[model samples]
Target: MAKSKRNVVTHGLSGLIGDLLVFRQRAGKTIVANRPKPSVKPPTTAMLKVRGMFRKAVIYATNIIQDLTRKAEYEKAAKNGQSAFNVAFADYLKGPEIEEDLSFANYTGQTGQKLVASIIDNFRVASVNFSIRDAGGDLIESGEAEQSEDGLDWVYTTTVDNPSFAGGVVIVKAYDQPGNETLVQVMV
Candidate 1:
C-alpha cells in the first residue's frame, strides 16, 4: 500500500482506476493499493457464518442510525472522522468483554459481600448480571449488578449465605447497548 501525496488527479480519488490498482480514502488521506483478487475457493462454513453475522451487524447499524436517540448515543461515542453508523456497526461486530482475572476474594458467600467486575465495550455497557452457583451446579442467587457512579465498574451484592461456597462458581454476564452479551465464570 502507498499513500497518495499531493497528486492532483488522485489526491482525493477513491475506487478502482482499472483492474490493476485501487484507490481509497481513509483517515483523511488517499491510499493506493493493488486490486484484490477474487477468491477461487468455495466459501467455507465458517466464512458463511461470518458473512451472516456481518449482515446482521449491517442491519443493526441501519436501525440504530435511524433512531434519533440511539444515533445520538452512538455519535457521542464516535471519534473524529468516524460516523455513528460506523461505531454502531463496529460495536455490533465486537461485543462487550469482561476483563479477565476478576477479583472474587471479597465474596465469601456472605449476605452483604460485594463483587466488583470490570466490563469493556466499544460503545457502552448497558448492564451486568451475576449468578452464584453451588458446587453441585445449583443456583444459589442471581441478580443484576449496579453500575458504578464513575461508570467504570459494576458491583453486585450477594443475597444468599452459603458456607460451602469454596467450590462454587460465580458467573458474570456483561451486555452492551446492541444487546451483545459476554459471559465470564470464576470459581469461588
Candidate 2:
C-alpha cells in the first residue's frame, strides 16, 4: 500500500483469477494440458432471421386479437350508456402509476449526516420506505417515510447514523396501498 497527499494506492489484480487443466492417464503414460471447456457460440444470422420472423408474427397476431377484444368490450359498454371518461377511469384503475422522479440529497453520506429523498409519482403514494445496505448486502438502516400534505410529492429526511452507509447501496421502495410496490436501487 502507498499513500499520497490526497489518496492511497494499492497494487493488486483487479479481477477474478482461476486455473483449469485437462489430464489423461494411459496404461503406462500420462498426459496433461491446459485445455478449457469449449464455450457455446452465438446465434447465426439465419437463426436470428427465423426467430425475428416468428416473433413478429406472434406479436402482431396477439396485438390484433387484443385490440379487437378491447374494441368489442368498449362497444358493448357504449351500447350500455357508459361514458368515455368511465372507460378511461376503468383502464386507469389497473395499477398505481410509476414514481418517475426520485431524487436524493447526499447520496454518499457519513455518520449523523442528513439524507433527504424527494419522490414524485402519478397517483397518491400510500407509503415509502428507505434502506441502506453494506457492500456485503447486510442491511444497515431502514424505516418508513413521511409524505407531504397533498401526497403527490413524498419527502424522506433522516439522519444516517450508520458508518457503513457512506458507500453502500440505497434502496427506495414506494407503494400506493393497492398492493403495488415500486422499487429503485442506487449505489451511494
Each candidate structure's TM-score, on Cα atoms with residue i matched to residue i, is: 0.87, 0.43
Q: Could you tell me the lDDT of residue 85 within candidate 1?
A: 94
How do the residues 1-188 of candidate 1 rate in per-residue lDDT, one tens digit apiece?
44446789877789997788998898878887899999999999999999999999999999999999999999999999999999999999988889877869777788988899988899989999999999999999999999989788999998889899988999999999889989999998
- Deviation in Å, model 2, residue 73 alpha carbon: 27
Error in Å for residue 77 of model 1:
1.1
Off by over 4 Å in 1: 1-6, 18-21, 24-37
lDDT of 2 by residue, 68-177 (tens): 66445444545367643344333333334434545454655555444445554433356778788887898877878776676555555555565565557878887652
- The worst-scoring run of ten residues by lDDT in candidate 1 lies at 1-10
Quantify all predictions' global Cα lDDT against the true fold: 0.91, 0.55
